[model samples]
Target chain A: MRFWILLQRDVLVAWRKKSNIYQPLVFQLLIVTMFPLGLGAGAQTLQKIAPAVVWILALISTLITLENIFKDDYEDGSLALYTLSGMSLPVAVIAKAAAHWLTTGLPVIIFAPVIAVLLHLPASAYGILMLSLLIATPIFSLLGTVGSALIMNLKNGGMLLSVLIMPLLAPVLIFGAGAVLETTLGNTPVGHITLLAGCFVLSLTLAPLAAAAAIKVNLE
Target chain B: MNKIVKFYHEMGSPPSFYRITGHWLKPLLILALLLTVYGLIDGLFFAPPDYQQGDSYRIMFVHVPAAWMSMFIYFIIGVSGIIAFVWRMKVAEAVMMASAPIGALFTALTLLTGMLWGKPMWGTYWDWDARMTSELILLFLYIGVMGIYSAYDDDPRKAARLAALVAIIGLINLPIIRYSVEWWTSIHQGASISIMGGNSGIKEWSMLRPLLVMALATKFYYLYSMLHRARSYLLRTEQNKSWVSKQFIEN
Candidate 1:
C-alpha cells in the first residue's frame, strides 16, 4: 500500500507538472526530426541508420528525465524522510523507479512509434522497435536511479551520471538497437529481443536494492 | 575463522597496510620491469613473426596483456569493494578506488594497440565488433568508478563506500556486458566471441609463450601500481592521523 501510494504520488506529481512528462518526448521528437535534415533528406540513408538514431535518441531522452528521479526529493530532504519512514528504503526505491518508468519511460515508449515513423524506420521493424523500447525504457530508469542516488548530493544531473552509467547502458543499447536492426534486416529478431527482456527482468530485480544502497550512502 | 579474522584485521588497518606494502614496493617494481623486458625481447625478437600478418601480429604481446589487466583489475576492484563493504576494510576501499585509474590506463593501452592492430588486420581503425566495443565500455566503467569516487571530495569515506557499491554492481554486470557484446557482434558481423583462443586462431606456441610472459609481467605491473597508488591513497586518507605523521618521520 505504501509503495502504491508513493508510486501514485510520483505519477500524480509528474502528471500535474506536465513538462516533466512532455520535455523528454519533445526532446526525442526534436532529435528524430533533426536526423532527416542533418543527414540529408534521403530516405534510404534514413532507413539505413534509423535503428541506431532512434535507439540513441531514446537513450538520451531517458537521460534527460533521469535527472529529476531523486534530485528533487534529495534537494527537499524528502529522500531522507523516505528512508526514515517504516516503508523500507528498497521498497521505496522500487516505487520511485516504477514512477520514473511510468512518467519518463512510458512517454518515451509511446512516442517511439511516432519517432520511428519520422525517422522512416522500416514498416516491418515498427513492431519490434516498439517491443524493444517497451522493454528498454524501464531498464534505463531503474539503472538511472542507481547513478542518480550516488550523485544526488552533488547538485548536477546526468553530466556525471552519463559517464557513470554509460558502460551499464551499453548492453541495453546493443540489444535494443540490435533488435530493431535485426527486424529491419528481415531476421526473426527473437534472440536480441529475448536478451533485452532478460536484462529488463534482471535489472528490475536488482537495480532497486543497489539504488537503495547508493541512496543510503549519499544521505548519510 | 580466527585466522581469516586476523588477516582481515591486519588489512583493515591502513597504517599496517601502508607499512606492509611499502617494504615490497621496490622489489615489485624491479620484478615488473625485469619481466616486461624479458617478455618484450622474447616476443619481439626471439618469436617468429606470423605467417599471415607478419610482424604486425606482434602487437598482441602488448594488447593482450593490457586487455587482461583491464578485466583483471576490474575483477580485483569488485572483490575489494565487497570486502570493504562487508567488513569495512579500509585497505580494500583504498585498493578499490586506487585501482580505477590504473585500470583505465590499461584499458586505454588495449584500445590503442587494438586500433593499430586493427588497421592492418581488420582493415579499419574502428569496428563496432563486440570485443572492441566491450573493451571501450570497460574503459568507461573504470572512469565511472573514478568519477563517482572523486565527485564526493567533501566526504572521501562516503565516496569510497558509494563507489564500492558501484564497483560491486559493475562486477555483476561485467560478464553480462561482455557476453552481450559478443552476442551482439556475432549477430551483426558473424564474428566469434574471441578471435585469439584455441587452435583456429592465433595459436602459434612460440607466440603464445611471449603472450603468456607478457601477461605475467602485466600482473606484476598491476601489483606495482596498485601498491604504490594504494599507499598514497592511504597516506592522503589518513593524513590527519598521528600515525601518518610518524610514518613520514620514520621514513
Candidate 2:
C-alpha cells in the first residue's frame, strides 16, 4: 500500500522535474541519429548497424540517467526520511526503481521504433526490438538502481557508476542484441526474447533488495 | 595452539603481515623471473617440436598457463569476493583487489598468445571463436572491476563491496569461456586433457613433467604476487593507524 503511494510520489516528482527524464532521451536520440549521418545515409549500412547502435545507445542513456537516481535524494536527505518512514526500505527501493523505469525506460521503449525506422531497420525487426527493449530496459534500470545505491555517497559517482554497471549490462545487451539480430535475419526471435524476459525477471526480483541493502550500508 | 592461532590472527593484521611477509617477496620475485626464463628457453629449444605443429606448438607453454590462470584467478577472485561480501573481511577484499590486475594481465596474455598461435594455425590473428570472445569478455570484466574500484576516490571498503558484486555477476562468463567450444562452433581446439575421459592425445611424459612444473610455478607466482599486493593494500589503508606506525618504527 505504502509502496504504491511512494511509487506515485516518485513518479510525480519525476514528472515535475521533466529534465531528468528528457535529458537521457535526448541523448539517446542524438546518438542514434549520429549513425546515419556518419555512415553516409546508406540504408543498407544503417540497417546493418541499427541493432548494435540502438542497444549501445540504450545502454549509455540508462547509465547516464542512473547518475541522478539516488544521488540527488541522498544529498537532499530525502533518503534518510524515507528510511525513517515506517515502510520497509526494500519496498521503498522497489517503488523508486519502478518509478524510475516508468519515467526513463518506458519512454525509451516507446521511442525505439522511431529510431528504428530512422536507421532503416525493417518493419519485421520492430516487434522484437520493442519487446527486447521493453523487457531488457527494466533490468538495466534495476541493475542501475543497485549501482546507484551502492555509490550514491561516493564522490564522482557518475564515472564510477558507469564502470560498475557496464560489464554487468553485457549479458543483457548480448541477448537483447541477439533478439534484434535474429528478427533482422528472419529467424525466430521468440527464444531470445524469452531469455531477455527471464533476465529481466531475475534482476527485478533480486536487485531491489540488494539496492536497499546497499543504501542502508551507505547511509551507515 | 591458542597462542599460534593468536599469532595467525595477528598475521592477518596489516602491520604484522607487512613486517613478516614483505621481506620474502624478493626471493619469490627472483624465482618467478628465473622460472619464466627457463620455461621459455626449454619450451622454445629443448622440447621436441610437435609432429603436427612443428615449432609453433611451443606457444602452448605460455598460452596454456595463461589461459588456465585466467580462469583460475576468476575463481579465486569470486571466492574471495564472496568472503568479503558476507564476512566483510578486509583481507579477503585485499586479496580480490590484488588478484584482479594479475588476472587481467593473464587474460591479456591469453589473448595475445592465442592470436600469435592462431596466426600460424587458424590463418587469422583474430576469430569470433566462442572461447576467444569469452576470454575477451573476461578481460573487460576485470577492467570493469579495477576501473570501478579506482574510480571511488574515497571509501575503498564500499568500492570493494561493489566490485565483489560485479565479480560475482561476471562469473557467468567463466563457464561460457570453458564450454564455448562444446556450445558453439569454435575454431579453438578442444581440451587435450579431460578428467572425465582418457587423454584425447598422448602427450609424452617428458614434456608433461616440465609443463606441470611450469604450471605449479605459475600458481606459486600468483600466490606470492597476491600476498605482496594484499600487504601493500593493507599498508595503504592502515597508514594512519598506530600499529602500522609502531611497526615501522620497530623495524
lDDT of 2 at B73: 97
Model 1 chain B worst lDDT window (10 residues): B191-200
- What DockQ do you compute for every candidate structure? 0.85, 0.30
Please give the TM-score that candidate 1 achieves against the real structure.
0.95
- Candidate 2 residue lDDT tens string, A1-220: 9888878988999999999888887898888777877888989999988887888787788788887788889999888887888889878878888888999899888878777878888889888888889888889888888889877877677876776666567667777887898788888877667767877877877788778777875775
Query: Judged by lDDT, which candidate is best?
Result: 1
Cα RMSD (Å) per model?
2.0, 3.9
| Candidate 2 ranges with C-alpha deviation above 4 Å | B1-11, B15-27, B172-202
Q: In candidate 2, which residue pairs get closer than 3 Å at backbone N, Cα or C atoms, i.e. clash?
A: none
Give candidate 2's whole-model lDDT. Answer: 0.78
Give one digit per residue, the lDDT tens place, for model 1 in B1-251: 99889866786799888887888889988989998999999999999977777898888899989998999999999999999887778899999988899999999999999899888887889878778888998988888888888888888899899889989988998999889888877777786434464336756688788888899889988898998999999999989999999988987
**Top candidate (DockQ):** 1
